[model samples]
Target chain A: MSEKNKSDMLRAPFKLEYDYERSTGPIIGKFFEGLSNQQILGTKNGDNVYVPAAEFDPITYEHLSEFVELPETGTVKSFTWIDQPRKHHLINKPFAFALIQIDGATSSILHMITNCNESDIEVGSRVKVSWSEEKTETIKDISHFELINE
Target chain B: MSEEKKDHFISPISLDYNYTAGAATTRFLKKVSEGKIVGQKCPKCTAVYVPPRGSCPRCGVATEEEVELVDKGSVESFTIVHIPIPGNPIVPPYVCAMIRLEGANISFLHLIQEIDLKDIRIGMRVEAVWKDKSEWDTTLENIKWFKPSGGDDIDPSEYRFKGPE
Candidate 1:
């Protein structure tokens, strides 16, 4: 019956974490394998090249097999800037989640752009892949992107 | 590139969150820091909830009256944990119990200490073994664990969930 109702509440930062073994199957696995060697790959749908190889054609719904290697450089088509990142985010500093279209590829892939200010980036900003020092054969192999100073 | 193609990937996911203990439970924790245990008494069914969460589940009524309880209880049920918990100082094969405190209708979970794993049985008497008074804070964790109190074993059925008969 103290005046100060000071008791510890369960309001604290908590981290729920787990590691799961996931099967990449065939098509997606090949793309990850290419990332391990610092290569970017896409699947061809007629005249268009789709980055992050699609397993089946969107229009025809047929299995597409042709793989095309593309450049790591890309242009940010759409993005949302994170002024303040949370603890779970891979990049602790300010960054942007971007939909980037790789040069010569008709489709875009989702990735992060870091090490820049808000004024340094805009829609259609030229960026290049910033590879992680360690390779895990996953999308994280391409850790993030940086604005190309061209 | 080398020959092998990858088949499997280990995906590690980490989620951050905030957990808040609402009103009634907050009052209970404050009592615990002062070296007392308390619960909220339901207005409708009159069932006492330890570490009270404000509302009664059976009657769906607010439990406003606070009922203070002694730091003693009986083990309604218990499990001896064999697997080691990450970042826990306790060794394997410790006893975790569902303790039904005296004056409370419901049971709450806490660790049991100062006894062998085999000797632990249902209906056994136990008392809260709290941390030093200086270390006490507004948390259920004020009670470090529970220990045997050398009292006669109460009937297990006494602490069983009370429902409409």
Candidate 2:
């Protein structure tokens, strides 16, 4: 084929973009605000407490309004070791994405666990939230969970 | 309860796509780049389709015959866009029309220009205005826009397809 034909058959670059601005409503909005101040907050639905503050009762389906301040330290319920990290991952090095059940909260919150090896961590391992030096009103405000000395 | 303003956040998203134009579309686009209009004719219904799909939508049979279509055709329907939108190829107050090419069974949507927006009417004759030969490519963008072909308007009844009652 000719050079002109080759050029004609070349694929064109196309990009799709969407810029969206939205409100987080009353429930999740307060959760992000607490993260900005380096505090962990949850919502209590009767006997059960949700760490990643749910907007509604998981069981009753009623709107949840009761807020509970949760301790930063928790135990790792389950974790998976990432031997190799991808570019989009929060941490560049190997880390574990774990479900940590914070103190006084019944439901566990999923987060990254770092500053330890694969062999050093397991289920029921003690961990604490590590606050970022620069806090933003986002989940990234808590850098990652670290292994507790105890 | 004290009335407090709800907090809002902005999130920006971007995605890229690499599409492969298959066999039938590749043939149609190649002819378009060569300053020609080609359509695939359905064997069962004799319907000719521009930007030819490999198979007939109604008959569900393969369209194998290539039919050359005229650049001039009639505008079956049109609407003048009055509201401005982001990333629009053309400004507001322009006309977008569904044009049925002569000798083709289907009508396709394209921008109509070089005529008064209000003057654009049903069955108005129009023709494709192609870009420079050097700028031509295997894409519909090669045809810059459809403009009034300067002829008497055809009767809408003649172009309208009568479906089974």
TM-scores, all models, native as reference: 0.70, 0.78
Against the native chain B, what TM-score does each candidate's chain B reach? 0.88, 0.87
- Give the C-alpha interface root-mean-square deviation per candidate: 2.1, 2.7
- Predicted complex 2: DockQ: 0.49
lDDT of 1 by residue, B52-153 (tens): 988999899888998998899899999999998666898988999999999789899999999988889999999999899999987888899999998799
Give the clashing pairs for model 1.
A8-B138
Off by over 4 Å in 1: A1-33, A41-68, A75-77, A81-95, A103-107, A114-127, A133-138, A146-150, B1-20, B119-121, B149-153, B160-165
Best prediction by lDDT: 1
- DockQ of predictions, in order shown: 0.57, 0.49
lDDT of 2 by residue, A45-132 (tens): 8789998899998888999999999889999999999979986677999899999999999999999999899999999999999999
Residue A73 local lDDT, model 1: 98
Candidate 2's iRMSD: 2.7
Candidate 2's error at B79, in angstroms? 4.9
